[model samples]
Target: MTDPDPQPWLRLDPRMLLVHPAREVVRFLPVLVGILVAGGASGAGPWGLLGVGIPVALGLVRYLTTSYRITGGRVELRRGLVQRHLLSAAIDRVRTVDLTATLAHRVLGLATVVIGTGSVAADADEQLELDGLPREQAAALRVQLLQSGAAAADDAALPSGTPPVPVVRFAPRWLWYAPFTSGGLVAAGALIGVLSQTTELFAVRIDVTEDDLSALTGLAVLGGAVALVALVVLLAVAGYWVVNAGFSLTHDGGAWHVRRGLLTTRETSLDETRVAGVTRGEPAALRLAHGARLSAIVTGLARSGESGAVLVPPAPRDTVADAASVVLGTPAPMTAPLRAHGPEATRRRYVRALAGSAPVVLVLVGAVVAGASPALLVVAALAIGAALALAWDRARSLGHTLVEQFVVARSGSLRRRRDALATGHVIGWTFRDTWFQRRVGLVTVDATTAGGQGRITVPDVRVGDAIELADAATPGLVAPFLRLGSDA
Candidate 1:
């Protein structure tokens, strides 16, 4: 079917004029104050005002100069004082439109509309965000954009029939045990800070006579042992709670919107076609709890801010699969049971964990030298135990699947996890083996997705199998000669 014709543009509500010139002014006040205070203290005199005043004035001017108009067919933004700027994009190019209101804006009945378009203008793909718009006006503008021809392309691509919106999902409230469990660590850190400061100021010293040492050692043994166990229990619970907050995946209109976060709520939406990958994560303890988290990598959305990916914490495994199907445009394949790798692979992961604990080991060693007795050996043993537990967890969490156009990896203990990436989204691929891995015929496969840092590395796969998996996931990455070799 042919696409609908574009409509003519219309002016936005005059209330759009409320976008305060002072809002930007207020934003920079803290920095301006810091500069002013430092300069005046340093005897920069009125010269300090010159540094502060110019930038604030320039910012105010820029803010005042900015204006936006949402037409039936296009959105236009005009800004700049001395130099004029007019940015316009067809309503058809608009990819996604978002509405946001801070507490102040909510009180003022104003909202901001951030419109994302494929075309870039003035160094950004966000067409024109109309801030300080009346709530109705913002809603009307959103409706206009959604009804426009551009939205038709999005609607046509979505799966037919609306999916149910989750009214109640895993929220932070379900995990209050997290704070108490983790609160002591924060308290302990604060106590350490206080003690360190006291020591620096007063040069306090503990002199242990033989009898005093015996008593103090007994007390230390009791306190340290209790604190260590409490800290571990708290940390595990806190991690679980954090992994469970703000879990929601909703199908709104023609796109999937995932809202998650604990302290700061994050909402991300993407067209079905743009989803490049989906990942699930679970901790060992979470596995027993029958909870898993889901994450997705999608295209078209901004990589920065809260728009990059969808994070669902502590979702049931079935829920994760449902969300993945909605977001990734295909049913999530069943994950294979995790199997232990070769002995060398297991040893490598364990040794790596041990290497990471060097600093903690050194601290314990230092405590022994400081006449704290060799009791720190308990701490070292606990640390080693935690490391081994994590290694065992990883071994239990290892599994992968090759789907039609995606490669899926599932890992995590207590909390189980999975990641699915489309072959086409594989921007870069690499196979790496250290000298030791080479001798053992083991390798790692890494793939780069569109958003975020750090490559996704599946470490310790068999060398030949790793190459074959990489080729299956990203046929373009394999050489033509390799294609013949594979067929042969």
Candidate 2:
């Protein structure tokens, strides 16, 4: 018999017309600025202002051409004005469904639904997105897409009236840890950079004479520095609180649901089976403050903000660990004692760290001796001391452990991260040996998988240990490739 007819294609919500044009205009605002500038310089009329309509036309074309449908066990999308491309993926391959509503979309009662397959390629066609759907419809669609993959599994069917069990809820106290996370500092820096670039455009001027600077007392300067730091921390805390206002993780319908954000709400769902593992991180500043963050190693998700992989923002270390254990269904592997890399790795760490910091320290010392401020001498000493501390921490953190069916690896000083990846999810193994590594009898083994960063690296381990770890992590996968003689 011939196959049944496919479902009718559905168009995006009409409200998207308004949202898309605004987005397109912002995206090309720089070009629009240039056109206006050129027109003004040439003594032209307001005709150049019509350039804004180009984005509107483009948005209209996008809305007119884009269509999607779920039919014949597949989700298909057809879009593009010139290329007219079509993309489709099997329904069972849907790994995650994300619903996002920016300020504009929320204002228009619209949400964007993103469907991720298990493909990790950067190609745009690997995933399908519906840019404008009613908020309720998008939520329903997300559930439908996620549930379709598990329709045959008995456990996928939740009992009637079963409420979503909350795994983690936003805590007001968590805001105290935000300043140490440095997310705000990064945002502040970006904002400052953008403002600086647009200063001339805005016709802004600043005049601070040397005499004005000299008039400031030492105490006033110190107070200003303290105030600036406080301001940064305060801004960071406020931003964190606002963005993560109602953050919550819940389990229902055989999937993990993450909901967060205030002005721009986001809800993401991933099939429980697609969870490969969890990563526990302690950035230097956050670690010092005894705070930690957690992210899920999802099969089809990128390890970025846009991926909705973050399960816990910077919070108390114990609190993060508790949430991680709940997600993993076992004690978190980060608590396991790792087998350290040998003395050679320690030497490498120290050599690399001092090599980078020595020149800076020397320059500072020279400046101090050449009649610069005595604080330069202190700063040089602090630099050297910081380098040594960092080197020591990096060496200490360089290790790996096998906990149950999960392979755990820890690395980095400034951004210390411990990834505990399930061995069953490992699809391949790669052993890397540079000339120096070979000389030191050390190798970096990458546990390749379709999850998280796509690979978990156990660095600076003995070649024999690396081989053994790989073989043990995924039995028989690496043993057949080994040679009996020196090549082994």
Candidate 3:
């Protein structure tokens, strides 16, 4: 067998000339503005021209120099302005192909094609991105890359009567859980930070006089607080709605296809064979609301913030469970009752929780004893109550279970997560125990794999149970060491 001849180098869509410069300009706009403002204030004009000229020059250089092509069973990219560099990956190694279009790209009918082989190396070699291609071409290229090499051979064609099944779709009710998650708060903080930076640069003023607060009555103040809370919730819900608008997760052609976003659209295809596990996350607020978030544990895929790896946004726990079942090919591991770590683990959780809040509790108690306001006593009581609640939650969250070929670990209080990993994908095992854990005969077992976060930890399990779990997950891997120990 012989590899095909190399294909001719292909340039990015010429339309990128328009998009790239605009992007570069926006990226360096602050510097450009500073240069212009300084030059005007200092009675010099040349610096302003230089600032404006550099980004445009770089954009032009990038558009002219960047080129890529598929050939000889490899996807190759040659891109550099000052230093020539080449990056290539075997077609069989490709794990994901993502197509994205910003508002600008959409307007110009172009998309950025990102080809990922799931490299966890330095960021520079993580993926090959062609900034702009005609939307149709980008889509075609995504298909070609995903359906090439071993992927094509492994990808069985859909049955004649079977169509792609939609596992999850964005729903209006899901937005209710959005506000409970930290998404709104984070977005609000980021928006404020950007506005602060840009407004300060422009000497913009946002006036809120002390007189305004002084004039408010008790009812008015209460109403204002309520309004502020409502605003934050609204912001969070709106942000999630826009970013996840039209979101859908579907399985077809031996890949998981995720389509999402509104103003800046994205489509990602992930090879099903690379999926190793599924994570069901329930943040404190989301859990109270009975909602969960789902994401795939895929080999070599870097966790892209928010948009990356996620199969379903915050939705009903049932919905998340259904999605996880679809991805994992089984529901028992996800839905079955987890095996608790027993009384010792529960005691540890309470001790840790109380220890964390002890300092504040002591401070408040001392204040009340020193003739301070009796309100300090109430605060101390509240602190103790909160710690107890947290301890109970954490204890409840600690559990691990094994079902068939999947090993499930669930833990954490504030951000509880249940990870169901395929034992077949388990590559290694790690056992860790602190002095306290050793005293209690509890060990934390880490199931290391090539997928997801690379390790799934089942914390505070009995030493015997941890060893048994490890041995069960991968037969004979742990038993030999145990036999040696027994013989010794």
Candidate 4:
């Protein structure tokens, strides 16, 4: 009862590939008539059915040819018709077991599961895919993989788990934030572009006088712009609803459980003890709205570079704080006041930024005014001002501090990130100085580690402060590498 069931050899459901062919049926009349007119197929009525049957036939072949098994502490996959190919990954090294099911897969009650080593160090040519698993089976497999991986590879599994407690729950009011985040804007832009392109493909002929046609063209353009904006907003709002609706986070057993999505439900679980660090991203817009998003940086999980593994979807600062307390294990330092790198860094940023931007602005305003649009000058001035503000913000954000077992680094200008890395995970120190930084007696120190952002960079650090800070963050890790001229 204690051990998991041995993974049985599995094949994809033949119904999985029917997703696209189902579309052919939806447009059966048009597709069939077109095929008949073009003589694309040998026969008329039954022959057109072949268009829809091809994918299903291929799926049957794949279902018969491809096979996978998860047993004996490793996952094995094999698939190929002409040439046999086999790939295996140790269950202990598995960082992520991601399950995705589109509407089509859901209709057939199947999901595609990707088991990754959790490191992006490998190229895309390497894929760990086991497509079309039953939903319940996939979930069971994910749990088995995580539990095993956590206990052995990173000693991530906790002896016990806290009782199920809601860390973050959906708030209908936060729906307003949907338009600002990734899905909303992206969906809106895509909808606009698609509609515009579709309109372009249609042929329309009109006869009118030159002046009348001009007026009509202006009206059409204005109406089209308005329509596009409206469509974009609608799509964005709808997409936001579908992706983030019913979002919730809970602590169950030794892990954190996250669930979200509208049509295609997704649930992810991460063992708390195995988490390497925590990353908080504050986009300028989110910062303005007093909101932030948080992600877990864990030892074994493929991460979108820089963001780590996002745990908390964009939410209010208070919500983030609550989630952080549970994930990072303490009073959340996300909102804590951070130390600055000094006025010297600020001065350097301002001087360098404006120095680069001022010439372009001046040239556009003076010499280029007649040849180029005045709007260019205006844009340059605005960009220069924004860059100056961001530079100052970046300087203010520069700092590294040690709070007990945590080594925190604050950096970034526009999309500001605050990384709270566990001190025990700190592996080594990297110290580098640019020519300008050296002249100013400042250097950049990066804390290189095994997982989570790989390294945390603290720029404009005085050499003396950098060494002392490193010594504090991880006591003996950096001491041997440093030179104490007088002590030696």
Each candidate structure's TM-score, on Cα atoms with residue i matched to residue i, is 0.65, 0.85, 0.90, 0.82
Model 2 weakest lDDT span, ten residues long? 151-160
In angstroms, how far off is 287's CA in candidate 4? 0.8
lDDT of 3 at 370: 91
In model 1, where do residues sit more than 4 Å from their true spots? 1-64, 69-75, 82-96, 116-128, 136-164, 167-248, 259-267, 283-291, 300-308, 311-321, 329-331, 334-341, 358-372, 411-417, 452-455, 474-488
Clashing pairs in 2: none
Of the two candidates 3 and 4, the one with more favorable TM-score, higher being better, is 3
Candidates ranked by TM-score, best first? 3, 2, 4, 1
Q: What is the C-alpha RMSD of each candidate to the true structure, in Å?
A: 7.6, 4.0, 3.2, 4.9
Candidate 1 lDDT over residue span 1-488, tens digit each:
22365433444344433334345447767876877888879987786767556665665565577777655466788776887878787765555566666655665677767776633243653346665567777756665664463346555443335556663377544453343333446656766788899998899977768997667767798998888767655665556554445556666555555555443333444444555676666555445555555655655444453234544554465666666665666784434443345677777767777877878988998888888878898898888888788777766566666776777766554445566788787787776778888778777777777643324567787766677777787775665556554331
Candidate 4: list runs displaced more than 4 Å.
1-8, 12-37, 40-49, 119-125, 152-163, 182-184, 204-234, 300-308, 368-384, 484-488
Sorting all predicted structures by lDDT, with the top scorer first, yields 3, 2, 4, 1
Model 3, stretches more than 4 Å misplaced?
1-4, 28-57, 122-126, 158-163, 194-214, 303-307, 483-488
Expressed as tens digits, the lDDT of each residue in 102-130 for candidate 4 is 67778788877877676554654357777
Pairs that clash in candidate 4:
95-300, 118-301, 118-302, 295-311
The better-scoring model by lDDT among 3 and 4 is: 3
Q: Least lDDT summed over 10 consecutive residues: which range in candidate 3?
A: 154-163
**CA lDDT scores, all candidates in order:** 0.61, 0.84, 0.86, 0.71
